[model samples]
Target: MSGRAAGGGERLSYFEGYRAIGAVVVVIFHAYQHNRDPVTWHWPLEGTTWHDLLRATDLVVDLFFVQSAFLLGRPYLRACLDGERRQHARAFLVRRAARVLPLYYTAILLVWAISNPILPGDWPDLLLHVTFTQTFSQAKIFYTNGPAWSLAVEMQFYLLLAVLGALAQRICGRLRHRSARLAVLLLGIAVLAGACDGYRLLAVSAWRLPDTYWPAWFGLPAKLDVFAAGLLLALLAAGGVRLPGAAARRLVGAAGIAVLVGGSVVRLRPGFPETFVHGVYGAGCALVHGASVLGGSHGPRWARVRWLVALGGMSYSLYLWHEPVLRLLDSHGLLPERGTAAGFGFTAVLLLAVSLPVAWLSYHAVERTGQFVARAFDGEGRRREYYRPLPDLPAPPQIRDVTEVLSLRGRLPAGTWPTRD
Candidate 1:
């Protein structure tokens, strides 16, 4: 199956590359937290250097948004015009939700069992995470699972794609030429939103702005431009779009890289609509444009491995799972101290040893299985039932119930696994 449906018709495969790299960067950024000892883990880089990397890692999230829009938009656009497109929307939505919810919910459940005081105690926090809307409002975003916030943004983007698809259908009425124009117009909305926001911030005074400012408002829409850019590329690919010339393509690519870097540095202020303006939107748009025109493995040779690509496929799971595990290790004395060289070195080795296996196994076992089941059943309820606590939430009983499973290579005898519920 050509990695796409048979004769799938000029499927945009560019997203697969960046999507993988973005996931890796997020994990490495989080792992940096565990390797902070100046004595042991210390080498050539300073802590500030690592911090800069972490802060910049947020740009990777925007890449995910662009991919989401491009991949999700295609089916959505098709559904708007053709019966086949409509027929596949349910399956498509299921595949996306399945890819996200299982691992997210798994992490949430694991965290629930731990019951750390750092997490919010209120029911609202749980509701927010469960509904995939935590990132929408500022109340308490990035709770138990810090990275899930982006998934919330993606969920919101899903809603946006639906609206765009409907609007696309209404404006063009199934005419390919009209559809292309309307798509370009939507793409402009993405670009204009960015330009207008930048203009407002440069032009307006803070005191004159609205009283209730929301971060998600400006933040979420900033990503929309990136997604829209990718969607536009999809239309271009369908219509055999090309850069004006080779030189023009390279210059655009260079400009895109610059915008991506700059967007990462800009200060994101409140009081503007998310779509209309934000640094990330510009960065995301730049990334989408560059990827659309120049994509074909521009990175080093290491990025081309099947394992790297596979890890990229499960990158979301790895990203969501890695951080909490590192944090828990640190909190539980499993990780080393933050400032010491010896402590840092110890933590680095410990984290690599601990995280790799957990990540690989989780990807194969719970994540892969749950995702398959999710896409398989494609129904309303029972199949989607992902959460089920061990009765009474007791530690020993939970451990005992798991003692009978077949062993896979030399795992510590069943009795040694942590049993705390």
Candidate 2:
């Protein structure tokens, strides 16, 4: 989602799979947007179930938000609830910037060079984007690259989450019981999420702003509820809550998929309330992620498929470049003819073919390099190291399980608890 591995040398294959699927869905949605004949189907074409469903793919963006929040929030939640050593805010933010900014800035410059004309007022727009404040401005929200608005929202969330984590670290210290601390933190997150949802509703109802208004509906406040859903998942995981059995975990996951599909379908109906749409969608995301977390060492077999995991690794680049690539294809007459099912399918496939290799390159050259650089700045002196396999060497240290570490806390010395930070 943010091109960063999970904290503590762990990976959640299911979440990676989700990113891959969500990224592809978004690319397809964009292809549909640019390739569809305005005269025939038009934007927001109603009474056509399949077309409407394609349009609904826009909501998959929310899943990205949830994934980012859950992955990033989990470690902080563990520190608060389990007394693990917390990552310093400086280190946390620096790593976040490295994960996000490199590809983002490159995308902006490429988009501008390819599409936007240099003008007197363009500098300010570019400046806004460079600062990640583009979402706060109506004109600049989708200025160069449209999908980058979500990146802006993500950047804002990073700052907010860092502050909240610091605050939680302080507040959690005074609480005597872990349960009470967990309860307090959960309540705080819920209340904040509620306030955000209420602001979103007010924008639509009282301010008479359309849900499609970028500045009104796409900013950090409007999407914090979705992130809060992820934060709730992190809290549950940190608190060691699990479903009763594997059967229950599987059932819950199935139900989560049902809810996600059902919510998208319900969202297609005319005049559905904006108030409930996000809440339902976020809930579904949380359920699915929670089930995956509880499902044991390796999640569902499909999640670990080689190609899917690789695609997931490069999803951020795919998301960044797909729209511009789609436009380039259209301008060069490379896209298939518009307005037919066959044409749509061809366009989607063509976009993937052109975009996938570019994404792979970006991941290796930009994302991985940025992460390697970030590791060099680690405050805890954890450097990226390479090792060779040898029969004579002792077995590599196994990645410690968070639950196991927590369980052994009482027996271990206070300063000796196993920690990645």
Candidate 3:
């Protein structure tokens, strides 16, 4: 329950605060999208800049991915840079599975049960969800848990990190300069991401295929740049790389804020490729994240708020459950009518009130339990290695010169000669 878990690195409270904000923004974006029926009605602020900002808040999910990559990648990057080859790739997979699968599977099953009819053909989609390959499958990507496509992307990221970690270990062995090693690692990640982006753009432009069909936007390849940004920041922060003066750092932070705000409010239509837009948005988030790490905070008040910390702690669970819960609300007629200011406002309040408690429960029941199970496995492994049985001891050599000892003592007992008795 503390900032850090057992045997884990220190918690970045600022990132935690950012997660809370990002999660809330996602919830609001979904609320507006689901409730606003453009064909039927219109709210007072529906066409205003405020409404555009609300719609564009979906970009906040990039922030989520950035934070996830930075936080989760930090330890992996540390081990790789330290030239640790015995990182136990299987153990890494098991640990990640334990942390991610429980709630993810639960959400998938719940969505399947609630949304889809019990049909024979639907089983394949369940298999895809279980294996986290739905993002690659045409029929299953948006099947049950609508928002879980990101989880699929993230799963690929995890596997890729393991591969990259090994590569970094090998490369670090050959490189003498720490800076050069870091540069090589960054360049490798950038090239890979850029290659993916280029492929996606080429496919979109040349093939004349719909962008929505297994689109690169939702794929791990397209998202790699965002993750790479986070990884780069973590690497630099960990390596204690040089930075500009304090004033310059503050200016960097300010610029990050500007880009984020500007990107959200201004809409980009279909003409501009999404790859470029997302790259820019992700860059802004990475900049903000790096600046926060360098500057030592994400604004004092937001980072320090008790409720925000709690919300951030439960952000993952909230994200998993809120969309489905909103659908349930809409089906039951609990939510207000669509396309009204009051409707949007009320839906936001109601969803937040309901989703927070559900998220809290899921965190306690699911996420915390998964973490505990993982710790138990780690502890068991350590105990086996650390608490091995001791070796047997040998008896002391017999005293062959007892008679000399008795002569020197000069005060032997009467029972010394047991044979005489």
Candidate 4:
């Protein structure tokens, strides 16, 4: 495959396929988690490879972080490479908040409303969820929506990126070779992230610090390596780096699979340090993402398959709502019992049947509305009045789907930009 230069407004369909895959795996993992007692009681289901694979599916969440970092970092990195100054820090934040908050807050409020008892004691924790601070403490992470702890960690990434993006623009403004400057910046970030992950591993493994999954696993510092992996991939692509041949591509792809599977196996072990395990997992995901894009002339035709794209489109909503839906069904005893294979199959089918449609509706109702509002703030359609293109620099690349921008962003159009000077 010819090397394609990743650009400002291109969609990486291959990554979307991964998104669809990850979202479904997460849903299945959550379902299994909720019904673990009964599911594990069964003989074949308890110790089989199928059961272990389902248990290990939770590792896909880190893949989401890797995807997000690349997609989110692409545009800003492109803008910096293009020599655009005058950062819109305020507008940038508004765009980020607008993209995520509507559905997120709605989920939080829904949990609060339906939750049986909101005691006075729980008020502070509730506030943390509302403020997206739930990841800071172990206790607050699973109070309302169980899956939202990841969202809290992601929000921290967004805020950090927005601020650092602004700073990078200012610092890189005077550098003559923007690509070299970006490379240095990315390297610095990668090193800093590696150090953070190292410290976290030491804290857990050497110091006898608590390795509670919620606080230890969910912290931004613990996950920065994954985000940095994504960032570096994005930066390299924008700088027009490309993998060369079939052999190289295969090597990269195989390495990615090894890291991902190896890390998952390590993660599932009892005494392994989570920080190192997840760091490897995150790096593996980043490698997979980069190899997938760089190795293909166009993304795999399979990525364009209708059902997968549809699933990818609603992945966010599905991720957010599936846990609550499972809890609701479990509470009412509407879901099938998991002790028997037949019952477990029925439960999985029923959950998917019900959850996919609900998630689709939620995407239309909440996620789309949030994107529309965010675009309004970003001056999408109204760019003539509210937006001003800088005099000499290139116009920012136009992305087709707003949701993609919020989630994975767009793909770099092939053959559109020069691969080298």
Per-residue lDDT tens digits of candidate 4, residues 65-168?
A: 87878777776777777764344767766766776788888888887777846455467777999888888776778888988888888888888888888777
CA lDDT scores, all candidates in order: 0.56, 0.80, 0.71, 0.72
User: lDDT by residue for model 3 over 15-95, one digit each (tens)?
Assistant: 667777878888877787777666865543576877867766766777777776776667666655665434655566667
Question: TM-score, each model?
Answer: 0.67, 0.86, 0.84, 0.82
Global Cα lDDT for candidate 3: 0.71
TM-score, predicted candidate 4 vs. hidden true structure: 0.82
Clashing pairs in 2: none
Runs in model 4 lying further than 4 Å from the true structure? 1-10, 38-44, 84-87, 117-121, 268-270, 338-342, 379-421
Instruction: Give the count of colliding residue pairs in each prediction.
Output: 9, 0, 0, 5
lDDT of 2 by residue, 1-421 (tens): 5834455233486667778989999988887777667687554333577776886676678888888888888888988997898857788888888889889989898777666555544777788889999998988898888899999999999999889998998899889999899988899788879988788778867887876677877788888899999899888888888788888888988888888888888876788765467667887888887776765546667877878877888999999989888888888999777766777778889999999989999889888888777877757435544563634533333336777666665665434435543
What lDDT score is found at residue 35 in candidate 1? 60
Candidate 3 residue pairs in clash (backbone atoms < 3 Å):
none
Instruction: By TM-score, rank the candidates, best first.
Output: 2, 3, 4, 1
**Tens digit per residue, CA lDDT, model 1, 230-288:** 56555554444466665666666677777765554453444333333344544555444
RMSD of each: 15.9, 11.7, 6.0, 13.6
Task: Indicate the residue-level lDDT of 117 in model 2.
Answer: 58
